[model samples]
Target: MENINIKQSDGAASLAKVYAIANQKGGVGKTTTALTLGEALTREGKKVLVIDLDPHANASVHMSYFPETVTTSAHDLFFDDADFKSLWGKIVKKREWVGFDFVPASIRLSELEVDLKDRKNKGMVLSNSLDEVKEYYDYILIDCPPHVGVLLVNAIVAADIVLIPIQTDFLALYGIRLLFDTIKILNKVLPSPVKFRALPTMYDGRAGACRKILNLIRRKLGDKVFSTVIHMDTKFREACASGRIIFDVDPKTRGAQEYMQLAREIVRNENA
Candidate 1:
């Protein structure tokens, strides 16, 4: 884990690796993982960028961003002539339990699809824009919109990796396969070369249904899934409401402990 923080020149400040934290379906803790992991990565001394593509601006709101005040959003990136490089300058450096920085999403992002549909390179707009600022952070986590559209294609095109957060519920059981199929089609048709893995969130071991979902997911995905599970905890809510990472809010809490473990797993996977 220390080795990952040593800065091996994989290009945290010079080259950015875009990771799309996506799932077409909603309520999967997608934003939660983005905030917590970004926080953990920052704590490990890695610069992290979070892009909010969801119109709800949940990530932005969770980060204490007031949509009324934010003029530029992901919508502007796709429409406005302002160089996307300038977008990097708009980054609102957050004060979090972890020291990582983030670029917030605005409520106006919902206008992205309708705004970019007429453009020729609409699907690749995000990727082209990110090229100008890819070198500033080690990780660029994009929180995708929860539906299939031009916005989603843009996100898929921009990502080198996709981390899907699957909820431990019966509803999520079928959605996983559907999401994978969508990814496959995107790779085949949209031609976005992206790799992906599943990370179970809001895990509850006490529930028999939860255990069933976990076992089924592991049985199918094998080691592609993360080893550390994010358990349901009160501290997570407190941290999210406060725009702080779980560990920053309460290092001894269940949510905080699992996130730290998840951070180590991320490093290990990168090393392997």
Candidate 2:
């Protein structure tokens, strides 16, 4: 399987953390962050595996080939297996974006919850699968489903850390609290604990609601919030549509630079 491996020097994998880029609210740049941040990590020469866990397949859409596609997706990994060896082989090397491999999301994933929700040890499925082939990469990022469902639970159950992208608005803070409550529930259910940090996304500093929401998030979540706030940038979505990451599209753009800084911040904090 030809995969995207970083050629530069990104510090060796310190924690072996599986970070799930998650959000219950749509349009908060969850998939955008996953795609671009993975690219940024690759730029620094770190291996990254992105698992598109959503049935909507938004992450796959952003990162993978759209029209002419293959079938090795979340559904195939979890439900299908005539032979597990070929599963990892399906990971295509993204020539356009360096340093990342993707487990694409299938349309059949929409049927997963209704199909496998009641199965035995349901939450462990994706985690167990990753454990089987985790040595192929350093960082694993699961792009979770938009709601609190079986898919979300499975991702949360497996994550070492979670990066939540929250919009800067009034109701956004309330929704994020609900997401944290979900995390607490999953923490109690899983044997190993998971850590989390919230990032303010789609921010407009001129808006009072943006300031209010940030204050509320800081007051409630405190230091768990990421120091970098991602301001509104249309180029990011345009980059996705153009079949590339923000940094690849325009490295000098504020949004692209902020995401790069976010990656460095996370890497720096691992030792602290």
Instruction: Tell me how many clashing residue pairs each candidate has.
Output: 3, 0
lDDT per residue (tens digit) for residues 58-117 in model 2? 777766544237445667777744555555566434555556777777777777778886
Best by lDDT: 2
Model 1 whole-model lDDT (C-alpha atoms): 0.75
lDDT, each prediction: 0.75, 0.76
Tens-place lDDT per residue, model 1, 1-272, is 01012123453435767778888778888888888887777676667777888888888787766678766566667764566565555543445344666556677677766776678877888888888766767777888887877777788888887888989888986667776777878777664456887889888999999999999989988988988888899898888777766776888888877877887788677758
Candidate 1 clashing pairs, residues 3+ apart or interchain: 14-135, 15-135, 16-134
Q: What is the TM-score of each candidate against the true structure?
A: 0.88, 0.89
Worst 10 residues of 2 by lDDT: 1-10
Q: How far is candidate 1 from the true structure (C-alpha RMSD, Å)?
A: 4.7
